[model samples]
Structures are given as structure tokens and as C-alpha cells.
Target chain A: MDKKISVKVCLGTTCFVMGSSNLQELIETVPAKYGDRVEVSGVPCLGLCSIDWEFSKAPYVKVDDEVIKEATVEKVLKAIDEKLNK
Target chain B: MAMNTSTPKQTSHLKREILVRLIKAYLSDDFAENTRLIPYDMRPKGSEVPYRCCIHSERAILRDRAIAGLGFSIEETEDSTLLSELANKAEKRDVPEQQPLTVLTTACKGCVPSRVYVTDLCQGCVARPCVNTCKFGAISIQNGKSVIDPAKCKNCGMCVQVCPYQAIQKIIVPCESACPVGAIAKDENGHAKIDFEKCISCGKCASACPFGAVHEKSQIIDVLKNIKAGKKVIAMIAPAMIGQLPCTAQQLKEAIMKLGFADVYEVAQGADITTKNEAEEFEERLMKGAEFMTTSCCAGYNELVDRHIPEMKPFRSDTKTPMYYTAEIVKKEHPDAVTVFFSPCVAKKREALNNPNTDYVLNYEEVGAWFIALGIQVTECEGKEFKTESSAEGRNFCVTGGVAKAVQTLLPEDLPTHPVVIDGLTKQSVRDLKKYAKNGVCDLGNLIEIMACTGGCLGGNSTVNAMKPALKQVTSYVNSSKSIKEQVSGTEQVKQ
Candidate 1:
């Protein structure tokens, strides 16, 4: 019931190698500012490129239902900042 | 002064231009003189794996015919520029070209009329029959007039027909009428269904599908893992990749490295090797009384033969494709490293997976999608040099006759032999080749180089963008690089 935002990263062959797995490690153990409202997870290929874009780009991650490109620790945090009010 | 229709001189000049452009686009062969050929002991173990360097040999003929249709001369310099300019007009020229209507019905809703063009003659019919016939009750009378209930009407034409006035028009979407293949079938809800079997994968439907529901597959997820693993990943790039990418080949390689691949290698380099080996193999085959020899570089062409010309199976040369061959060498050198093949062909998916050496194979279309999915703009990575071995012969593998040109280096100086090169292997051409093989009347001199698609890998089904000019650009790019000696030496700034 707590208002926790979950970030799921695709560790499929493309994402994991493009540093998605590493990015997930970076996302874990959040800073004090966000407190316990955030959580991170790793998932399989969401078929984003396959069904949505068709291998035009990659290194993607998803926050709940939204997709983020060029997935990195900085970008994911920035995305988390935009969605949540400080 | 005669508006010269029969200008053989002009036509021959134009033909040269076309061939040059084609040579640039296909970029099939390089290193016609010197390159290592694969040893016979390492040939692919199963029939599932393609053994020939030539794919779709018939398609080469299509490219030749397309070039011949222009009536240009190979000897003319000016014709070279013109042909190169138009070499990859396949999809470009086809943009305005529409598909037939039967296929169109698969995706389109029936035409709807633009504003009710009700005639002035719509008299206040005493019967009120038109309004009564409207099932949806779309027609309604305005003011004192007996106007139909427009909102309730389903636009079934029942109202229009009921009205003695005859007033109704429809607007249609051109896309719905363009697909000749019934692959694009409509659903009960009016969306489209893409039957893969029915679909020729011609992409006409994707182009025409206004909603953009149908699309090519993506392989970004697969590519990302190799980059992050931090292994010595070598990207074996297809020759057509030279100019088509927004950045130069070096820059694209740099961008890929920035994303984290260990190194980049050109598959054309493998072609340089393949050409020499296959030429030698062809000679040996002829010596052994093997009357017919077909190049097998093209996976689709191989599939075509397997599916259509089972009898011609013996004619296909037993050489692994350049991609596979190069992967094999890389695999041997860096036992722990992974190799990724970046090609313009979709069938390469099948090719890469089957090759024990190729860790992964993703076409240009899939890579393009991955770029979008990752939000990595290739332009941002521009100007970065993606380091590679300098090999001119390997780089020229992007065009038609490239294999033949490359193999010519292996042929003896005075061998009295004639080899035929076929481009764009269509269904008809394969049948023709079979006929020639069966009749023993083939003038190919027992050796035929076949590319399944029109421009070989440049014309593969999975490519993300146009590949014509890219072929020429890569050839020049290859020419600027060091000779084949620099590729295998692995001494060009080798990093542990």
C-alpha cells in the first residue's frame, strides 16, 4: 500500500550488455532523499525493440509502465526525479 | 541532332554508370589477388549451414538486367556516376509505386463520404422512407425539413438508395488498395492481420499500413549484453554499412565501442579470404568432373535452392559465408571473446545462429531499433573512429560480381575458364539455372556466382534503410584502407 515506485530493467541480451545490469546495481541502495519510496528490479526483454521500435535503438529500461532509453544510473534517477515530487 | 533514341554510345556510357553504381552498391568482392582461403577440413558440418559465399545468384542477374535496362556501358566513366546514383533505386523508386487493391482491403475500412453531399432534389418525400431505412438513425430532419438522422445512420447506403435523389460520396485511403498479397487481412474490429506465410516480406504493407502496426524485429537486447559483458567483442560489419550510417564506418565503430564492444572487424575481409578459397575450390571441382558449381554466399539463395531446387544442392559450393568464416577465425584467435555480426540482411539471423563462431547476428533494421530503444543517437557518437584492420579486398564485399572479382586473384594467369555471375536470384532465374544444370548446356563454364537478393547483402530483407550509395562509399572507404595484409596480422594497435 506504500507509495513505492518500482524501476524494472530489461536484462535481455541487448540491454544487459549495454550496461543495463550494471545500471541496476547502481540503482539499488538509494540515497536518503528518496527514502524507501523507490525500488528496482531486473526483467527480461520487454520486446520493446521487437514489437515497438524494431532494433532502431536500445539500452532501454522501464519505470512501471513507462519506457526510458539509453538506460544509465544518471538517466534512470533523472526519470525517477521527474515522476516523483521531491 | 536526331533526338538520338538509338545512341549505342550514350546507352553504353549509361550502362557503365549503372554497373559502377551496382558495383558500388553490392560491394561483393575485394582482394581479387591475395587473401587466405579457409582450409577444406573446417567446412561446415551440416547441410543446414550454408557452404557458399554467393547467396541468391539469380538476383545478380536482376541487378544486371536493371543495369542493362539503362543501356549503359561498363567502359564509360560518366556512366559510372549515373549508375552509382541510381543503383539502389529499388525501394526509393517503389515509394510512389502503389500495391494492388485486393491487398489493400486487408487493412482499410471501406471509404467514407466527405460531408453529406445531399442533393437539392431531396424533396420532402411524403413517404419518410429514407429516414425509416436508416438503421443507426443517423438522419434527422432539420427545421421543418424532413432531413435524415445523420448521427444514427450507419452510412450503409440504404438511406442514399432509398432517397430518390441519389446523394452520397466516399473517400478511400490509397494504402488499402496497394497490397496485392492477402497477407494484410482485416480483423473483425477492422485492424489488420499479417500472415507471415502469405506476406512476401516485401514491406509494402509496412509502408502502406497507416497505423505502422507491422514492423521488422529488433535485436537491441541481444547486442547490449555483448557490450556489457566486457568481453573482447568484435563486431563483424557488412560492407554495405560503410556509407549508409549517418557517421563514417570508423565513427559508427567508435560509437559501438563507446557503447562497449571490444573491437570491430569487416566481414568483407572474410570475403577477401572466401573469394580465394572458393576460386580454388571451383577449380578443384572442375578438375573432379563436377560440371556445375554455384556460389552459396547468400543464405536466402541457399534456402531458395533447398526449398525450390533440391536437385541443384550438389552444385552449391561448400564454402562457409564470409561472416561465418571471419567469426571462425576470430573465435580461434580470441577463444574467450564474443563476435557480433552487423549485417543488412534479415536471413543473416538464421546464418549467424547456425555459425558456431558467430555469437550473435543482428541486421541493420534491428540495430536501428536498438538505437531508438536505448535513446542513443548515432549522431552524438559521430566522428569517433571505430578502429578496424585495414583490408581493401574485404571491404569491397558489398556489391555484385564482388566475389568473382575477388576470386579472379586466385585464378591462374592464363587459365582458359569462363565464370558467370548472377545477381538478384528471382524464382524464375533459379528455375533457369536448374534447367541449365540438368541439360548440361550452362555456359557458366561449370562455375556460377549467385547472390540471392538483387544487391546481395545490400538488398537483404532486414536492412533498416537504403543501401545503394553505401555500397560505393564502402568500396572507396575500403580502397583507402591498408591492404589485406594488415587485417590478419592483428598487429594494427592490438589491445590485450
Candidate 2:
């Protein structure tokens, strides 16, 4: 039995305004091969902006507790792949 | 919000950003005293040259843009009035008859007209195929190179096709190339000017202009004023708006309410009504042995038929558009409420102006600006749980073929229905439509769905997201909704 990969995309004001609006749709469209293993959801605000990390941008995504900075479709997918394989 | 890498997209986005900032400032507490310096504040003394020849010229263009943002036509005013004075004038006026689109002459590049010319690659062949192929004697050999006579040339491009070197090439102005209705043409000074009669207000020209010279006049201030004056303003959200902003539809509704809208109604619900009505009308027409019925949801498509293909108007579905149906519902339920349509189209601005039910219109970009100016973080807002009784099919109206799909769902499965979908209204599509209208041909399909924008409403010029992502969002949103039967089963019939 494989564990479902939990993917949380930040939908905070900063993230949304910074172009995270498309990420939800992008996550929904993750390849059918990963469909059964990955679960994608949107968090209103990840509160990453409060953290002063240089890479803690608005569009932060956490794939199974591994927070990916400056997240895009490709970055998130890659993170999902790494977690699923791990 | 991902920065568009393209220069033209960036410039247009900047223009919208500046307008939003200006509108936000105007609505602030100390606006009266600081209004005069808004343009200057936006483009301070030492700002880098953004677009034009100099910083001053850029600021001038910004000033004109600010004026257009206030719902005033730049063509009507040349006065060196202060921003405060302009604001005061804007406040005094009723909802003015606004032209859907305007061009800022200051920013116009006055691009050269599209012309076929022999390039340096022209190898002056002894056979003179270029000269021989030209019916108008426009091509001649000069100094061992082919020369096109501008005076004698009919721009037929026959010589180019006949030339072995393929030296002849055509140069097209971006706005002229983008206009499907051929509304934009060069003036005496070579600046692009729109013929309003021929213009469908598709806004393709505005988006296509690399210089960002073309603009759609906004009614932001008017709508704001209405809100401030305690008028009950009901927002009729378009179907395409599902994925336009970052927030969910519920959150977006709450954010809209925070912007002082009395209530939010999904235009998708109205689309559901349109689907039912259009399907019934189609069946009736088919039974009556009518030629064909074209869907009438897209304002650009409607306008194209109205202005360019009047003969096809009879074949166009008599049912009202989703927006109209939505506005009808809103106006009837809340008669005093001012219905403001939030669309993803510039053509809808014109449509709203002509409509009695809809009092004002705002595109996704303009409303996004409003959200920014008001400091309304959409994602952070606690969304109200109000949902419309619109079906999945109705909400799917944002994408290409969505209408046909919705109509198909309503019609009987065994019905001999042949549907044709015209995804985008290009020159060739218009020609075909005109030919069909002239010939009264019903062989292709009993029902034809024509979307003016390439990807339907989601592909509207003012949309925030790109087409592919937006379509994905819309599709998922539709998939999550209830079926048409469940949504529209008990709803009262909206008066036509």
C-alpha cells in the first residue's frame, strides 16, 4: 500500500496576487499516473510570508512537509515525484 | 500575477495596475486635496522611461489613461485640467454614454500600413516572373532588384507568390491584424483609428497593440460612486470568472460583497437559464424546418452578426444571452438594485451600455484592480456559502463548445441534432458565415455555436490567467457542480 502524497498550495493574498491562482488547476491536472497517489489542496494562507526565509515567497507549496519555495507547476510536480518515490 | 514575459502584455498589465492604483487613491479619505497630483505621484520626476520617447511623454500617456479609467473619453478632452477638477466633473455626471474602446493618440506608434514589398532577397531573374505575374504592372526590375510600385500596386501579392526567390513580404500593424471586423485603419498621420460603427468592441486591438495605445474606457468610478451613494449594487459574476482570481468562487463572492456589492449572483445561473431557453428554441426551430440557429451568448459574435452579417441575424437564436437573462433575474428580484456585470470581455461593456437591465460593467482585470486598491486579500477573506442553482453545464459556458455541450445535454439523446462549433471567429469563419447566410445552407449543422475569442469567454482579452489554465479551472469547477436537471428544475421562468 502506498501513502497518498499530500500537496498544499498557498492561496494567501501574496500568493494569489503573485500568480498562485493557476496552481490549483495545475495540481488538478497532474498526470493520471500519479492520480491515485497524490492529493492536492489549497490552504488560504500558508503563513510562509511571516517567516523571513529568503525563498519564502507567496506561492509556497508544501509536498509532504517539504516546503518548496517559489513553487510552480513543474516544481510542485517534481516535489510530488520525489516524495512518492521516497 | 506571474509577470507576463512579453513586453506588450507587461505594458498592458502596467496600464491596468496604474489605473487600479489611481482609482484606489481617488476613493481614499484625503483624495480631494491630493487628487491633483495623482499622475505626478504615479510618475515622479525621475522615473525610468517605461514606453514612450521620454519620462514626460510616458507620464502624459499615463494621465490620458487615468482619464480613460475614470470612464471619460480622451477624444472629447484636451483641457489641461487638474485631477481634482476631473474627479469633480466625473462625480457630477450621470452614467455617461461611454465608447467601449479608445485610443491614446500620444502613445500611438503610427505603424506603417501593411504592404507587400520586394525585399533585398529579390533576385532580378531574366525571366521576370515577378513582372509577368503582376496583373496591375506594379512590379518592375530596377538596378538588378525587383521594385514594387506603391502607386500602381493593388497589394494583391500575386508577384510575391510567383517570385522564385520569395522576396516579397507583407508588414502588418498589430492592431489592424488583430481586428477581425476590420474596424481599425490608419488615419492621415498613420495612427490607428477605430471606426465605431464597424467595431464590435472585441478588444483584440487593445490587447494586440504592442505600444499599449488602445484602451477600453472603464466605469469603475461610476460603479464606485453608486456604491458610495448607498445604491443596492448587485454583482452579476460572469461564468469565466470562476478561475480568474486566486480565491474560490465562494471567497470571491465574499470579497465582492466586501467591495460594497449588496449581493453576488453567479452569471452561470443565468447561463443555465440561457441553455434551457436556447435548447428549447433550437428544438422549436428544427421542428419548424428553419435553416439553422446560432448561439447568441458571445457579445463579439452577436455584434459581428449585427454589424457585418445582418442577413445572419434571422438565424441567430432569439433567446437572450446569459448576461441578459441574469440581469433580468436580478432586476426583477431586486428592482432597485443596480446590476453590475463582472465580465471577462470588453465587448460586454458595450453590451451592458445598450442593455436596460445592466447598469454598469467591469472586466476581470478592472475588478482585480479594485480588489487590490481596496486591500481585499481574497484568499484571507472568510467566504460566504451562498451558491447559485446553476448546473455544471451552464458554468461550462466559459470554454469553447461549452454552449453546444450544454444544449446537447438538454435535447433528447435520440434527436437528430447535428451541432457545429465555431471555436473562434476569424476572417475565414466570418466569410463562411456570410456565405452560409447568403445561401441559407442547413446541411452543416442544425445548430452552430460561434465564440468570437479563440477559446470562448475564458480567452477574453481582459482575463487574468492564460487560456489553458483558465480552461482547466473552469472544467474542474463545472465537474464539481450539480447537473442541469437538479439546478434548473424548480426555478421560475425568467421573462424574455
Candidate 3:
């Protein structure tokens, strides 16, 4: 059995303001074969905004504990692909 | 001087977010139970106030915004019911009025009247040209400055012109300044009021108002209700929706289908037909020795001509809009289906009101919110490759000069067709159009293309992205399409 990938999206105000409100929708379009293996959840403020690093931006997403910043639909999909292939 | 940067863009985004959430809630099974508490849930007592004086006022404004989103204008009613109650009543109504735009008085800052005022630069010139220019004794020397009497001043700006120091400055209300036809004015209470009779529903005022007092009444709830009732809702996607979402047009279609829309059709298909028909009409008109002809694709420009420039009406091409043609095709294919034109302009909302073929209009912003609320990621969706026979020229109709270019391409190479493209409508452009209308012909061009919004439909008020990038995306998309010959052949095959 394939291990399920848990994906957490930051719903912080900063992230929401940055147009991350619709990132959850990306979960719905996962191919039917990988549907069960993917789990998507919305988490309030992953606290990425508080970080001082330049790479740490709002709209942070964590896929199986791997944090991705400035996440777009394509970027998140690519991340999911990497996880599924691994 | 306000600390809040409540620009019109931010205000529009905020309103769209609330509406999206509300629509999502309405679609849920537990909608009836939780409908009343949406405003409070969105804005709690302890939450930070973004725009208004306090959290309560902010919540109140949100409630009113949500009400406007649900397609009902908030009248000055004596009923003291909660906003949720009003939403409940609004949701149950069969259909909303045809009023496309409304003013949220609660959100209005009630700005000062638009007038010309004296500034500190007033040198109290010995010449006193300001006083001489004023036919009425409105200007007077007071405290080493030229003061204009508010009652006597006609706001004619003659004093502004005559003053060599340029001391006089015009303080314009943002909404009033944005309106091309002077339709928006202050009511007795100083709140921004829209005169529906004079308003062209161009949505310029809505985009111009810093307070975001003016709003386009949405038809999302009505569309949702129809979908919930198990009706086949066909989405006629406009050409302007090319790069609005973070997905290709094919992927966007698949995502829309996921939202319970029976199917999706591109309005560019209609644009192809319009191009052919309009080109033929143009040639016929020119042969008959008629003056220059204008493109009729822009509903805002059409409304402007209808309302203001009456003489120009005769010269406008009598071609039905792309949405009209597309909706007709949808109706022919599925007689039972309700056709909703997914547009990128506010004027189309008003256009849809009079159009029997198109049942409803949803702007790109509302559609984006809907996608977000439904958790339908268009970019992630496997693109459903529907065969499109639309030409590059037809698909280019979303940008400035696209219509003229398309028509010019269809015309014979030898024809004397000089195209004049009005990239954006301003007071100056309107004056030029009026000049052409009065003079019958201008040396500039015999074929005129007037786009109300700068950069055409991509720069429409409801568009999500800025103009420059969106234009690039649209141009690339158009370039990628099939040639005009191939498209015409495919369209003919479809008709047969």
C-alpha cells in the first residue's frame, strides 16, 4: 500500500491577502489514481510570516513535513509529484 | 489622512472574499442553520478593524457587501431585522432587479462636494484675472488668497484657467471623477448616489472609489440556485478570461465542469462569426458611401453612444456581441440549459439584462471566488482538450485593436481600410468620437475601434491581474491559436 501524503496549507491573514485562499482547490484536481494517497488540510498561520528569512513568505505549505514557501498551484503540484514518485 | 490603505483594489478583493465564503456556505447542506452568523464569524468583536471606525462597523459593512453580492440592493427600509435575516429573504427571492450597480451608503465616507478651491499658491495677483473671468461675482480677494463662493461658483473652472499662478485646484470626488457620463453625484446626505437612468453601468466609479462604496450587484446566488435545482448550466467563457485564473482555458473548463456546469463554450467561437459578419457589413456600408463605421463589441462603448453620443449610434455596426452569438449556439445545442456568460466587465451585466439569450452574467472575480470556495484548483486539473476552431484574430478580441485587426484581416487586401484604434476611452477620446460623428469622416481612419477600458477586456474592472502582464498572456494565447482559414473551415463543419 502507498503511504498517504499529508499536505498542510497556511491560511494566515497574510497568506490569504496574498491570494492563497484558493490553494485548497488544487487538492480537488489530483488525478483519480493518486486521490487516496493525498491528504489536504488547511492550518491557521503556519507562523511562516514571523520568520526573518527572505525565503519564508506567506502562503507556506507543508507536504509531509517539507515546507514550501511562496507556493503556487504549479509549485505545489510539482512538490506533490516529487512526493508521490519517491 | 486615514491610516487604512483601503484602496479600491483591496476593497474589491475583500468583498469578493466574503462573497465567495458566503456562496460556499450557501451550497453546503448546513447553509440554513449557519447563514445568519457569517458576518459575525468573519468579523469577531476582538478582531482587528481594517477600514471602518470599529469592528462592528466593519462587520456591518461586510453584511451590506454580502447583501449586494447576493444580487439585492439595500433600500432604505424601516425594517430593523438583522443582516442575516435580509440575506435569508434575498436568497429566497425568485430573481433580483436588473440594476447592475448599487451604492453602499454605509460604507460611503460622504466626501465633500467636487469643486474648484483656492490654494496657498494664490499670489493675490494685481491683475486679478480670476475675478475678471468669473461672469458671476464668485471670486473675491480674502486674506491674501482668492476665495470662490460655493453658492455662486458654477465649477466651470474659468477661474482655474485665468489664474496665471495656477493657484486654483479642483478637488474632485473620486467616484464622480471616474464616471464618464457624470452619472454619479452626491445625494442630499452627501453619500455617493448613482443615477441609474444616466448611468451606463461601465463600473468605472466602482473601480475609482477609494472607499469602494460602489459595487456591482452579483448574480452568483441565482446561478448557484439554478445549478442546485438540477438545471443544466452552460458557461459561455469570454475571450477575456484567458489568463484570469492560474490555469489554461482547457483546465479552467474542466474545473468549471467540476463545479456542476454541464459544459463550457468559448465566446471566441462567437467572435469568429461576428468578425465575418461585421467585416461583410463594413464592406457593404463603405460601398454605399457611408462614412466610417465603429466596432460594436464593447457594450460599455455601445451604452455610451446610446446615452450620450446619439449621432454616432447610426454608424455603429449592427452586429450582435460575441456573448449573444455564443449563447445562441448553446441554446441551440441544449434547449433546456441556462446559458451564463462568464464576462470580465460590469457593462456586460447590464447587457445581459436586456439579452434574452444569455440568462445571467458572472464576472471573472466572482468566478474566481466560486472556484476558491468550491476548492476547485483549475491549474491542477487535467485539461479537457475540447476542439476549438477559433482564429487567432477572433481570440485576440479581448485586447485593444483586436477587433479592427480582425475585421481588417477579413477585408480584401486592396480595400482602403484605415483602422483607428481608441485604446481607452477618456473625455478626450469621446470628443474625438463626437467629432467623427459630426464631420461624417476623419482622415485618421475609416474603421474605428473603441475599447472603453484601457487595453480592452483584459483591463476590465472585474479582472484579477494588472493590465501589462495580462495583455502579454492574452497576446501569447492568441498567437498560439489556429489560422483564420482553418478556424473558418472548422466553424462551417460545426454548423453543418
- Whose TM-score is greatest here? 2
- List candidate 2 stretches off by more than 4 Å: A1-86, B1-8, B30-35, B125-128, B488-496
lDDT of 1 by residue, B123-232 (tens): 66667676687677666666534564456545466666676656433232323333333445555656455554444333434333433223333333334444545567
The regions of model 1 sitting more than 4 angstroms off are A1-86, B1-215, B226-232, B372-390, B444-446, B482-496
For model 1, state the Cα shift of residue B102 in Å: 21
> Which residue pairs collide, candidate 3?
A25-B375, A25-B377
Candidate 2 TM-score, true structure as reference: 0.84
lDDT tens string, model 2, B72-138?
A: 7776776586666777777777885557788886667646777897788877789898889889988
Worst 10 residues of 3 chain A by lDDT: A49-58
Candidate ordering by TM-score (highest first): 2, 3, 1
Q: Provide the lowest-lDDT 10-residue window in model 3 chain B.
A: B1-10
After the best TM-score superposition of candidate 1, give how far the Cα of residue B300 lies from its true spot, in angstroms: 0.8
> What TM-score, computed on C-alpha atoms, does each candidate reach?
0.49, 0.84, 0.82
- Reference-based lDDT, each prediction: 0.53, 0.78, 0.77
- What TM-score does chain A of model 2 get? 0.82
Candidate 3, residues B291-358, lDDT tens digits: the string is: 79999999899888998899998899998888888888889888999989998888998888788888
Candidate that beats the other on TM-score, 1 or 2, i.e. the better one: 2
